[model samples]
Target: MIAKQVNQKAWFMVLPVFLVVAVSAIIPLMTVVNYSVQDTFGNNQFFWVGMDWFRDLLASDRFHDAFLRQISFSAIILAIEIPLGIAIALAMPKKGWGVPVCLISMALPLLIPWNVVGTIWQIFGRVDIGLLGHTLAAMGIDYNYTQDPVAAWITIIIMDVWHWTSLVVLLCYAGLCSIPDAYYQAAKIDGASRISVFRYIQLPKMQRVLLIAVLLRFMDSFMIYTEPFVITGGGPGNSTTFMSIDLVKMAIGQFDLGPAAAMSLIYFLVILLLSWVFFTVMSNIGEESSNGGS
Candidate 1:
């Protein structure tokens, strides 16, 4: 029997990333965890409070409302962006000078800073000297996002769609480009309808990329804070205050560090669980897709 030697040098390559994560993510997470179960007074004084903060947060109406709003917003975002992205990607030119043009146009929105996107939309949605708001007013529509909950929600959603749908389009377009011409040729030889070709060929081929798009959009939307916070200030009376905003309000606005830490942990768990569920379901689908006889 021959002995195989294992290289220990690979771990050295991974050590830097491990140290970075420990410094950046894990250390902060542990600090939060420590705070979640303890009460603190000024001057770094701390008293163990067990699960009191978590219990209070779980029982509070504010947390409940924020959770519901967060999930709902994420759902609406996914529903709108996924289908809209697919439609746009399908319509975009696959080749020629037009391809680069369309890609650059889509990529432009994504390059803007998050706060800048919110600022742009804020001004863009104002009735005075703002294009969208002014146009809506001229059309006789009452469209004040700062005061109206519905308008606030719509503005936030639209801003997200405009900013992030480009990501989905690019991912889907890449998936489309990767599909071999042989599949389309065979479809044409079979005299397949456009709808049939898409259903059987393009869709199946795009499944992996579509899964990636969904997960990315879902996580990003769920954690969205900067854009909405800047646009709405979590106002129109807390109607647009999702979990992230609520956490900020608790931690910074009210100076409730213990409760904020606990709430943050819960919020983190919810996202973690949902992402796991999505990954599991999508992985199974991918497996079945590969296994199914064509």
Candidate 2:
């Protein structure tokens, strides 16, 4: 057999990306790690603190509350967006002019910037001049997100659903399109019910895409800052103060560098851990499904 040499030129092509990542991500991460273990006083003086900040954060009630709020927000987002996206995708026309119209409409929300989304909703939800707020007031519902915690939470959750559900819809629509026509024909021959067709065929086919959607939604919802910050300012008395928002307050608002750095690292690790668990559980389910069918 003749020996074949591998191409060494690929590494050169990838070097620019590697350098960019190092400059953009790696260096800032290293700086945060350095800050995580140190304390600073005036006159640019510093002292070793070594996990004290992390310990305090772990013991703090505020930190626990922020974490719970973050988890709750992500949970609510996933619950609302996933099934809704799937339903919308299923209802969309598979072919013809309506398909483009539906797709374009779905995509428009995603095209808006996050800050702009928050601003639009903020104005839209005002009790004075905004249409939604004015309509609700006319209906005699006392709604003010600025003063009510429940209202603020509801506003942010709805804003997130409006913004990101299109991503899930698009992913799921692609997944459904990938399913061969033969499967539907088989179901038709078997006189399968619509629910059965969905449960056994569409649902199974969408597992991988659903997994992707779930993970993406979870991470984004967990780390959400810009939209909620602009809309609610984490307010109505810490009602919507998620981990990222709280972390920003600790770092920028309070100038608590050590604690903020520690919290950021912890935040990253929690997201990483949960994503791994989701991927592992879904991959196992997929494998079992494949084996059972075989």
Candidate 3:
């Protein structure tokens, strides 16, 4: 066989992107790593502290609490949003004027900025002027997110679901659209029930996009900050203080650079590890299903 020449020039075309990534991501990450290992007390003075910060962070009850809260929030949102999104997507019209209306409505929430979302919800949940709060109060339910931990938690969770579930719905809808009419036709000819049709056709066909949706939602929920911060301010006594919130309070709020840096690195690693696990398990399941079908 004759050797074929490859296009080495592709490397040159990609070099600009590599340089940009190095400057934007790699450099900042290195700075964070540098800060993670040392203590500073003004005048650009930094002293090596080895792993003391990481040790303290690991032992601290505050960090553990924040971590648990973060985990719970992520789990709750994923549990709710995935099913809700799927149901909404399934119920949507396949054609006609309703399609554009439904799509626009779904996309409106996603188009709003994070901070704007928080602000809107914050006002909407106010007991005095907010419609939701006033209606609840008029109905004699003592709903107050500002002073009640349960209310605060509920508000943030609902806020997150409102803001992000649209993303999952859109992705799932796209996946569903990509599926051929032949599958449904075959299922109809076989007289398969709705559940069986979904399980054998729709669900399996949407697996790849569902995986993407799951990963995106997980990461976003796990690191959630702005909405909760603006609405609850992690208040009602640290009830909504997630890992990202706590990290900011430590680094910027208290100016504890060393410990904050350590915590940030640990936070990054935890996210990376969990994402890997999710990808691995889901990919394995996908492969097994494909093999079985083949």
Candidate 2 residue 157 Cα shift, in angstroms, is 0.6
Whole-model alpha-carbon lDDT for candidate 1: 0.94
- Model 2 spans > 4 angstroms off: 1-16, 42-44
Candidate 3 regions off by >4 Å? 1-12
Candidate 3 residue lDDT tens string, 1-294:
988778688789999999999999889889999999999986889999999999999999999999999999999999999999999999999899999999999999999999999999999999999998999999999999999999999999999999999999999999999999998999899999999989988988788888999999999999999999999999989998999999999999998999999999999999999999999998888888888878
- Give the per-residue lDDT digits (tens) of candidate 2, residues 1-294: 977768788789999999999999999999899899998764667789998999999999999999999999999999999999999999989999999998999999999999999999999999998888889999999989999999999999999999999999999999999999999999999999999999999998999999999999999999999998999999989999999999999999998888999999999899999999999999899888878867
Whole-model lDDT per candidate: 0.94, 0.94, 0.94
TM-score of every candidate relative to the true structure: 0.95, 0.94, 0.95
In angstroms, give how far residue 230 of model 2 lies from its true place: 0.9
- RMSD to native for every prediction? 2.4, 2.7, 2.2
Model 3 clash pairs are none
Tens-place lDDT digits, model 1, residues 107-175: 999999999999999999999978999999999999999999999999999999999999999999999
**Residue pairs with backbone overlap in model 1:** none
Clashes of each: 0, 0, 0
